[model samples]
Target chain A: MKLTDLVSRELVNLHLQGSTRDEILREMADVLAANGRLLDKDAYLDAVFAREQEGSTGIGFGIAIPHGKSAAVKTPSVAFGKKPEGVDWNSLDGEPAHLVFLLAVPETAEGNEHLKILQMLSRKLIDDEFRQGLLQAANVDEVMALLETVE
Target chain B: MISMKLLAVTSCPNGIAHTYMAAEKLSKAAEAMGVDMKVETQGSIGVENELTAEEIAAADGIIIAADKTVDKSRFVGKRLLEVAVSDGIRRPEELIRAFSEGDVPVYGQGQADAGSRLKTIQEIKQARKSRQNPVYRHLMNGVSYMIPFVVVGGLLIALSLGFGGHPTAHGMAVTPGSFWDHVLQVGTASFSFMVPILAGFIAVSIADRPGLVPGMIGGYIAANGSFYGSTAGAGFLGGIVAGFLAGYVAKWIKTWKVPQMIQPIMPILIIPILSSAVVAAIFIWIIGHPIAIVFSDLQSWLQSMQGASKVVLALILGAMISFDMGGPVNKVAFLFGAAMIQSGQYFIMGPIAVAICIPPLGMGLATFIGRRRYTKDERDAGKAAFAMGLVGITEGAIPFAAADPLRVIPSIMIGSMCGSVIAMLSGVTDHVPHGGPVVAVVRAVDNVPMFFVAILVGIVITALIVNLLKKEIPADEETEGVA
Candidate 1:
């Protein structure tokens, strides 16, 4: 239920290397795959892209929450990526996304668990302090430390 | 004395993003103004942080900003301001100011009206200015009530088919005197009340509680033209007339200046009696015959269509379903399909079901096929959209289409149209009121393979067309976070 439990050190990228949206999503999905949250990287990535075709999850304020509820996900999880150079997320406000969270939930996630996570994160995301902490974090541990302060 | 604490509730239709945003704005404004408050949000997951009965009692005022219904029985005696959820977002401080100025009206002693109509001349003017939204609102009010009946009744009948029905020449028929027969009967019983309740609520929405009796009466008459010695009863179309006519009549009567002594009895006696009589007379003479002709013509036209002609109808419905992605137009199309289910025209819904799933499914597939066009974040979101679309949640495509409505809308509409036409052409039939291959694979749909094929073809078309239309991803823009 906690976002920390769903997000892992392996999935958190302190410095994003991808210049394009596709590269960032692939790198982050690979991170999730490495962390054992994804069963099939290709299937999961397809789901992620499919979700984007529906709408950009770049909800504004330099953030993008790229998420999918797919059978390829082993667990409900979130992967974080930081892009100081920013990436085109085609956000609601047409701003590029800087802080990216790739959320994956099982197709059978009981009672829309992903949406609940998104809502919980949305409130925290609205706070200036939380974004400041995440942006200023240096390492994986530092990111974890910042995420722990979600409440 | 210091101002007493106030409480508010905010909700919108989706109840996810906007509802929370509104709640946040309202509570933040309240806190900044040094007022003690609690804000409850009715969201997709349901009510959060509900107000206690004691809290309702202790509150000095309440603001109910909602697009959907919010039960106010608990706040019966409180000073309340009821407005659209937009007010909670855009004018939260202004709403709080009204409470500070003690301008809101107290409810539960009588009707819990939104605000008092203290002015006479301006009241009519105020009413006219608000008319545009009210007509649509009133119709939605009727549709809202009518939907529960349709969904539950239709589903129960579907369940009856799944559990207790065997196919006849026309469709599934429950065995006489069996338990499934009883279930089917119950569902039929529910459907029987659909028009009356729809008419009743629309009138109540328009004319308040006084419209209830006359509206129901007029609706009952409309639904059963035997009262006027007509062979074919006026259908839902007639119900609309009855509801609006009764509502306006009751509303007009409320504008009358009865003597002070007669005012007490006016609402209970004179208004209901006069309006009911007038509505009945008008409906029997003027409305019923004309609407009956139109309704039957429509029913027959729909019923008689076949082959290519049927596909045309299916195409229009499919496009409508995917056009706004569950907005008002989509709801109207859905309601049309549901009405068909009640009349035992299962094939129309067959196509609608296919159309409903294609937008999300096709959009999801588009991301998969054209990976180079989308950003890394988008591709990931596409996976989720694909999954949601598979399960028949059309909203999965919303985020994508909302951002680029021009290309996305046309693409999804075409995809849905292709799927719908295919479903109709393939002779697919859906017994259940709901859509998607989920329903079909579960045996709620007839010709399951064809249904799957229709969905598949539509998804391919959508994915191909959209990916073809999509431009290459834009370079990153300047970020906006101070952090």
Candidate 2:
């Protein structure tokens, strides 16, 4: 229902260090794995890449929501990663993605609750200040504080 | 006087979270500004807290903070400001203060947005660079313009005949030297104007302003047939050829590099003159008689359809009318039926009218009778769709088709086909070019009982079939939806 419920401070990275799009997806997937959200890290990464092949999750506005609905995911969760230098995520507008919301939904998540979380993030990202605040956040606490206002 | 009431709409992607966030932010900002504000949210679920017509009418300034396309048709003639939903979240004060600032541009006043047109211009340039199908676009433009004229002409003639004329050897005849006779005469005159308007606007759609004169001239010639010294002109078929010829010739002339002094007069003088001459010459010398021959022959063939053949024709026409649900195929079939009305073949249009209402009315009924088969958004849409069907608009079924085309399309098509076939078999005849019970109530239809029966049966069949085909959402979600 709210970002704080799906997103944790441990998964919010103020500075995401990755060059290529795939590496960034893997890094974000690893965040979920480290937080015990995924049962298998490699499988989730593979699912994310498979979904990317259908179309880039880069939904323009310098934002990419790379997500996978896979059995590897043990729970529905979100991992926030901000790339300061921006990566070419093959976006709709061909712009570099500075803000990334990695969505992981369990294969059996019939409620589509993870999709709802993605909806919340996607809606707020339309606000330039929210994106800017999240991007400008000094640490995980600042990121968590901004996301708390999502409800 | 500044009107304190404000309306705002928020949307972005399919996510539910951000929409509420922005709405919360805007309401607070509106409160601070002493503005009575109501925010509407369009999310994955559906439109929540829709603005009533009264609220929309009473509101002084409107703000549309949407990241997706919102139909701005209703907001026409309103002082409106639209910004990204993010703007509402980030800069609400700036958006609200714009009402007092008087810098907000009025939207939907029959003008394209200045900034948005920049995209259209760029896209047009890109399209021209590739030379994509402008022909289809121009033809559709002609059809759109032609429709209103056809409706006016068709209904007037139908009403005049129904009220004032008796059955005659040839169609119906108004009483000589009576008030009914004058109404019939005026109605016939309106019908005669239909062809030229169709041709003129088709050309307008094709070559912009310059093609209008030539297209209209060509259409008049096509309709009269006497310009080419032939009887029965070419009918709507000839008008189509004339429209295309005039549009293209005008478009060709526009491409020529003229001197700067003469360029100013090209659209006003040179292009129209040259194009009209070309269209006249070609229609008279090359294509005019052949088109008239074909039109007349086809008109005779349609008038002769009887029994099983008529039922077959109605079935085909019905399926075509419902198949695309107001796409190119539907328009072509509708145009054919309207053109048939001009030729005094009322039965050809009878089934088409019935088919038109079946889809909308059926879909609406389906939602009501089989409530579990739809989500909450669909049930809400169902009410509007049903009402649209009563007035004979087929496009009301579009959302269901869009949601699940494979199932919805076939169901609606079957229902429309059955209705059309039954209407034809029962000898239902509509004089008016329009469909639905509203038109029938005005004595536009003969065999009115069968007409109603055909429509009711068709609506029921469509509702049953579509509901059976559609999978139900979890029932718990309905409770959640209300919550």
Candidate 3:
């Protein structure tokens, strides 16, 4: 239920090469697939797209958490993508996003478990040091290690 | 030689946006025409930059531009020009020119004969007031009663899902025989009355007691599509049409010759029957097919839309949510999502959920990120609105939009629409009728992470747009030197 348990080094994309929201989502879906955490990339993408329709997960402060629960997911997992050049995500403060957290949860997980993970991630992200460390994290391993501290 | 100052006042019902816009335009136009004008804006907190009694007494002319009632007793003895707020917004220059050309007439004095225009304005007001037939009054009454049903039904359905439903292999399903299931159904039944109530009231307003029977019957037909060859029928919109048809039919029938002794019975029997017959016939034969086609097309379009299709959908939902805040436009979108939930399409509600929260959430975030863009009152209201957004309340954004509609509406719309599209493209599905961050947290959202992302994106977009759009008031202007 926690970020450290749900996220792995393989799930992190250090540099997102895509320019558009779709390309980023596709790349994120692929990461979930590569980690064996997703059964169907298409379904996972559908879940992601569906969630986006409700509203952006960007709660502001240059951080975005995009998460979904779908049958396409083989297991509950989290994928971290950092866009240094800052994609035009239209952040609340008019700032481009530097840290992106894409969470892919199993469709059947207990509702409380999902909330626990979001609470953990949101609380930690609000801290200046925690977000700064995550932003400066040189690689996926560093990001994963930092997330483990929260766990 | 004697000279006099010209004073003008502008106001609208809500006392925001249009009121200020009209004031600004009028002031600018008056200045250009060399008219010494001091315009006061009556907004939510009452009047701002008020004119003194001496100034009013010295004015040779006065213009009152308002939709709501303005106290004209103060200017009764002066040369006054009265016009609708729309005329001020659309024709400020012409209004000023008319005043300069001495076209406005004096009132409340021996010179009343000199101001023919004043008599015409009075006649117009009288005509407008007299034109309000019983049908309009009854319709408004019905609508007033009906809104609570829609809100309660929609909110209860959403709450039931949030508290009771669990994700299943076949998507979200309520367990059979659950307490919440009963509650949910009860809520849905309340919503079912929305159309009937709307139509019935409109008729009652128009024709008084005579309009009630036909209105209710017409409303029933509108709600039930089997009579019209459609599955969903015309919904609330159909109710409106039915109400009008029934009212007019009943009114027409009232003119028929009956025994003078039976005149009282005519309203109870003949009018209701004739009106109901007309409404039923129209729905079954004339209007049914087109309404069915439109309803089916809407369903098909929603079902067929995929990934990229969300962008357009988001734009529309966002526009609706922000257009009038919680007014008719917002109701239309909200009702569309609720209807879709009954039809087992959860994805259509996805974008709507996102659109509903973005306005308040985004404004709340703006207050935290930047303090200069908002007034003290706005920042305070933003805090409360933020909490409202978590519960998926769209009315929370009304205060901000009212304060600066031109700038705020567009900002929230762009943000909300962007978030909505992203949610759609992400394939997020919401089984519930209502939306909010709280709903997502309660496992009401299918794609939890994408729900977060969608909200985050929306918050960012709204904040950015609002910040960018806000015109900064200079700091120096805030502090004036004191000797």
Candidate 4:
């Protein structure tokens, strides 16, 4: 349930080049699939889209957390993506999102595993310094090392 | 000598919160801007601070900020400013300034050349015409009265299942010839009228008295799927369609002029017959078939989902339940689960039950764990929401979500979805058409131990996530101003 245990270097897209919301989601799903952590890319995409239809996961403060529990997921994982120019997420504060957390939980995990991961991420995201550090990290390895302290 | 008066009306959905908020804001803004104004509030109890007919006659302009219908025929000859209730809440100062500056235009029959009065009159007329149509006025009147039935019926059935029904090998059932069976049946029968009433009022709102028969018949067909080909028929949504169909049909039929001898009969007889046939045919052939197909497909898809697939399903449901905190999307997911309960699939309800409690319980727990993160209004609502959550009322989370949708929605969704997945994996099931811990306590849920576990886990997850997501409240601000 640790942040590092769930996120991989390959899954981290430090520079996302998408302009629209759907494109960003597609790009994030691609990163997870490329890392061999997903069973079906389409299914994972469907799960993300389905969650979005319910409401945007953008929890304000220039942050968007798009997560879903899907059978396509081989294991629970988190993908961190930073948009340097910021993406319009229709945030409550009406600010573009600079930091995106894409959480992929295995559909069958038991004993509150996903919950534990979510709690860790939510806590860390609230701190301005932690958020700044995550956004300012030079590369994926630096970001991964920073996340290690969360657990 | 030149003289003019301005009259204004304000309203909101809940009538208590936003209504007063808008009224207070508008009053303050108008006073500061130095404008002559008399405001009337049409709230839940009824319209207060009566606006006299003389006031309407003399007023050069009118401002209406309301979600519900406001009678505008009285202001048919005046200038008006019409805007959403949110405008009043967020931009009252600007709105008042615009009105005082004569920025709005004249509308309706009062377009005479007072030259200076032209702009003010035009604005008032535009506001009045766009407020709420006569049809919507009547329809809302009916919906307002009809909501109590839906709430009462839904709650009663939930209560019966939770307290009186026992889990049999077949499913959750009340013992034959038992008193509880009658009570549950009565509650269900009350619910049966929901669709008919919805349609009837919609028609009555549109075509006055003549549209009733056609509307009711249309609603009945909409709710009963035998008319089409699906076992699972349309519910309240269909009622809305039927109401509009019947109203328009009746209106169209009434316009056909017959011989002088048959004129009276035409209003009573011909209109009803023609409108009913049109409504019934549309439901049976056009609208009914497509709706039936979709309903059946949804049912089959739900039934076909297996163990792992169920987890994915749970996550989607949980996320939706917590998303808007009882807004349209939340209602859709909740209603879908409730509909499935009548068809003997309790598993779908299991995840819903867990999801419902997450937001309130989570937020409530946050207050205890991190008191500095929430305002006093939120903290107070948190306690009540937690209690409501224990009984499975998802609406308990509305205050928090409304206050901060971005942070609160995702936090709650993640926690609730996690709980839903766990419940689904455990094979928990619920038999009632409602959710909440209250339903489970009454024996409505299958595998009671798992149900309790699911709810407990969901609550814990939500609390943890919320506490983590939120920043501590600033210590400098007084807690009394938190709301």
* Per-model TM against the reference: 0.38, 0.36, 0.40, 0.42
TM-score of chain A of each: 0.90, 0.92, 0.89, 0.93
Off by over 4 Å in 1: A1-151, B1-132, B222-238, B259-262, B295-417, B424-448, B455-483
Error of 4 at B461 (Å): 12
Lowest summed lDDT window (length 10), candidate 2 chain B? B123-132
lDDT of 4 at B192: 75
Deviation in Å, model 2, residue B85 alpha carbon: 25
DockQ of every model listed? 0.08, 0.06, 0.01, 0.01
lDDT: worst 10-residue window of model 4 chain B:
B110-119
Q: Per-residue lDDT for B164-271 in model 4, tens only? A: 766543334677678877777886786677677768777876776788889888977877778888564566557768988998889878887689998978878888
Worst 10 residues of 3 chain B by lDDT: B474-483
Q: What lDDT tens digits, residue by residue, belong to model 3 across residues A1-151? A: 4667788777788899888666887888888898788999898888778766654555455677666767888877888898888776654446777788887767565544544554456446656688899889898778888888764
B1-483 in candidate 1: lDDT tens per residue?
A: 246598999886545454665687787778888888799889776789988655775688999988788866456667899987757765788888898888998865234234333323233222222333567657656655665564455556656756676544333467999998988889778766766776787888788888988888887887776766654455555676788888999999999998999999988999999999999999777776665565455445544543347868898889978876654346556666777777888888899889888987887788888877775545655675665565455655654664456788899999899999989998898876667666665566888888999999998998888888888642321111000
Residue B279 in candidate 3, Cα distance off native in Å: 1.0
lDDT of 3 at B155: 61
Best by DockQ: 1
lDDT of 2 by residue, B187-291 (tens): 567656656776887798778799999999998887776776554566555676788889888989999999999998898889989999999999887876665
Order the candidates by TM-score, highest first. Answer: 4, 3, 1, 2
State the lDDT of candidate 4 residue by residue for A1-151, as single tens digits.
5878888788788899888778898898888888888999899888877766654666566788777668998877788899989999875457889988887767666565454555556546655688889889999778988888777
| Each model's fraction of native contacts | 0.12, 0.09, 0.00, 0.00
Off by over 4 Å in 4: A1-151, B1-130, B133-139, B169-171, B307-310, B316-349, B352-419, B425-435, B442-483
lDDT of 1: 0.73
The prediction achieving the highest TM-score against the true structure is 4
